[model samples]
Target: MSKLLNDDVKEMLTNILKDMVDEVYVKVYVDTLTCETCTETHQLMDEISELSDKIHYDLVETHGDKTVGDKYGITMYPTMVVLDKNQEDKGIRFNGIPAGHEINSLLAALVDMSGKPLDLDDATIEAIKAIDTETNIKVFITLSCPHCPGAVTKAHRIAMLNPYVKAEMVEAQTFHEFSAKYNVSSVPKIVINDTHDFVGNQPMEVFLDTIREAA
Candidate 1:
């Protein structure tokens, strides 16, 4: 396959990954039969894994290996799960191709999984830690939306800090069924536990408050 990431991007990724102190595993679940961008997603992950020795990835066919997909609760194509050194699922999921603005979200997830402390505010961290119940956050987005990255990063960082939370970034265009089910009309639409949902780019406190109320 041709390079999905350019030379400049590769160099940038190398610099960004230099801060990684621990191993980060990327598990990519792909379905070639139904997903149009599965090939590109695989190639993109392959290019990224080459940028750093700390990064490794496994490619699993969603239909061919249903057990792994079921374990991760993967229902969409080209889903990527970023795991920690122990191969623990930190609830960081990319439900479609992590290109365009969403690339930043993917990078941030990798860095967090490498045991680096996130730059979130202490108040936000405390708020997330106070939650006692398991929270599942799903942020629906499109690759073209500039504001979606902030939403995704906020959710992923919260999940990184708190064990009770699992956050996923679902590409709206790729998962039309989910988009319809969630009544998504714009980017950065956040759904908590498949019940409470809201739209727009929300602040960290607002996100925590929403989760607290939902839980």
Candidate 2:
């Protein structure tokens, strides 16, 4: 009845978010010159911050700040790390956006973890397992784009690890017609059940959330 990320979930996030005494820091690690995804990555972060005001964004260019990268142990551009108030340790790290549904799930997990230090109960696990059993999600991707490979690998890895997940590769240049038909204007355009779609690489939690919703 509601969108994948509903008002209730948003409210829950806001509540837990309000309870936090420390600031949540989001660091965007990128290479200013060589990184092809820098511009779009900034745009995506902009969108994310617009959705929630709890995030503090800091753009760090790889070449410009060696000490900063060393401090964070960042070796990859377009890497997003969620740090707690202290900024000493990493709380949640997403390699790529899994999906909208997956992001919401991770947010819920973060909130739950922050509010109460524990894991999901058996019943909840069973429900999650049931959801996995009933849901099927697939992603068609390519291997050429630097970003494409990581996304493709993540999708495949997730599919291999989860029964309901599936990912296929379509050579972008070879299958240009099919790609065009899907309105895939860029690399790694994930399509869910021929219904939902989003472009670019996403955080892992986000990707999982998207798959969860599709399921």
Candidate 3:
């Protein structure tokens, strides 16, 4: 029982949750509080609960009379499922501590797709004009695939840092038919405006040069 509510771990979680913004939905699951792992899991949940009002977590224990785990097909000790506001699963699953950047990226993607209009500031307008660009690169990838993140990151960085280039990360697993139509057998396949195609990873500098040429 001593491990069930570890003050030190709980405090750390509190600090992490405090940094959350208005657009994050975090769900934590704790199954079976008999083992050390389960105890630590509860501690983390305590931290998450104290983090922010937006952070929602549900605690589950196999020893207790609860069916949360069964509903979600969770037979593991700790599982986290992040869902968008529409209650749609973004397919991001975590078995351990997730990186802040990864979590923030998911939140940003959800916000962008939630019918929220993006207002372009004057700086954005200036940047767009400066690039004088013309090209859209659609990258097919899966959210949970480790390799897919790096590829999407490279493509996204190029788009943000260069106005002339635009990139989109399409969910390949969810859109298997589209992936087959595009002949995407890999995680980070790039299609230049549906005309040119390439596979595998490329460094940031190389990606910039390639996008420039495409534009």
For residue 106, what is the lDDT in candidate 1? 84
TM-score of each: 0.95, 0.41, 0.43
**Over 4 Å off in model 1, which ranges?**
63-65
Off by over 4 Å in 3: 1-131
Decide which is better by TM-score, 2 or 3.
3
lDDT of 3 at 113: 29
Candidate 2: residue 46 Cα off by (Å): 1.8
Per-residue C-alpha lDDT of model 2 across residues 23-66, encoded as one tens digit per residue = 56667776767555565556655554544565667876766555
Q: On residues 88-133, what C-alpha lDDT tens digit does candidate 3 reach at each position?
A: 4443344332233233333333333232333345654354445555
Distance from true location, Cα of 2 in model 2, Å: 26
Model 2 stretches with alpha carbons more than 4 Å out: 1-22, 64-68, 96-119, 122-215
RMSD of 3: 10.9
Error of 2 at 135 (Å): 30
After superposing all C-alphas onto the true structure, candidate 2 shows an RMSD in angstroms of: 12.1
Point out the higher-scoring one by lDDT: 1 or 2.
1
Worst 10 residues of 3 by lDDT: 95-104
The stretch of ten residues in a row with the least summed lDDT in candidate 2 is 109-118
